[model samples]
Target: MKKPKPLRQEQILGELNQAPSLRVAELARRLAVSTETIRRDLDELTEQGLLNRTYGGAVRSLGTEPSVTERHTLFVSERERIARAAVPLVKDGRVLMIGSGSTTVHVARRIAVEMKNVTVLTHAFGVATVLAINPTIKVIMLPGDYHASEGATVGAHTVSFLQNFHADYAVLGASGLGQDGPADALIECAAVYQAMVSQAARTVVVADRSKHDRLFPARYAHWRDIDRVVTDAAVGSALAEPFRQFGVGQVLA
Candidate 1:
């Protein structure tokens, strides 16, 4: 059966999340729809501010982060490896605070499958959902205004709520990982991330290679604030220098 227009449009955005740009013909072929249908769907999604029309097909809207479902389609293998590397850092029966993002979702999956008797506090609906699969894990949802695009909660409410508890570790994902440290594309999320960093005994940043050297507006923490970074990218002098300088450990997956 053919998917409805709304579902089909969502599938289009998911494809764009895997690869930022899309071509109409390819989208039509993959979705089993006519080119004209794909074009119309793209046009409607663009008008709705979910995506931007390009010369050929579409792209993610400027300054807009893809939804968690869309982001799950991206960097699958690398994210899996990074998640596996991060799992060894998590001890059994510890309290963890995790931030929102696709990579963090991968980490949550690892915690579900490989660990037990752990408590997780998060504002991301996706993270909480994944952790729920593990019977031994305790999932705590934080209070805040929900951001649908990211599938997470953010705002002063979320940050304030984090103040009441401390965790053994705070696992976070970043939009950019530069020499200065980890940063988020959305300013609202940065505050929640900063709060988690301050309240945890240690902080780990999980990011893929694409985030390297990029600069985003909301700098969550300086290098000194992070305890370690887990990624799939090979660390060269440029990336290694900052970690070494700040005494932050880098784990390559």
Candidate 2:
């Protein structure tokens, strides 16, 4: 007779939450379980609306999409324009949280140069490292699973870290923005963004013109979640209307 399988549902759930997406084989290796066992667990989670079953793996139910780094290199000039518009919003002696992305990196660099006596919190290693050398600024990093490609930490650890602090403002970047809301490349990052929105007294979404009409895999923030949006003038009036409809304040540069 074959031996009965061990109950590994919690372990499987934990793994999926950490990585957001993982193949069955990878899950098995991580959990030291059989592929069939992982598959069964995935099915159960899918039924519970906690996981989404994909071709050969499972992704968090939030959505499956590319990473921020993958999208970063695609729109260099547009991102820079957005960054230029976002920088002036930072004020000295305020607590701020900045999200991760190449455009956000630009915002961080500008902040390092222009702002002082500010406490900045982030999950991006690149952002922390850049600002670390600034004597007048304090940088706090959230801990989580490191996504090497994007150079940011994500997952529950980051989420828990964000829950502890409230910020004066948050400057965030998005992969896509629709008439209804903002979306992100990955479910995990979206969760992080959502947390940032809640913890910040004011939230500003920094996006380039190219991201205005695009829709990514996950909708993380509604139009109302942002207090203000800073983007380039290239974001045409038509695309900016939805933000206004949602009562979001807009600043174009």
The candidate scoring highest on lDDT is 1
TM-score of 2: 0.69
Residue runs of model 2 more than 4 Å from their true location after superposition: 1-74, 234-238
- In terms of lDDT, model 2 sits at 0.76
lDDT of each: 0.86, 0.76
* lDDT at 89, model 2: 74
Candidate 1, 93-199: lDDT as tens digits = 39999999999999999999999988999999989999999999999999999898889999999999999999999999998787788898889999999999999
Residue 144 in candidate 2, Cα distance off native in Å: 0.8
lDDT per residue, candidate 2, 22-45, as tens digits? 999998887777889778878866
Considering only N, C-alpha and C atoms within 3 Å, which residue pairs clash in candidate 2? Answer: none
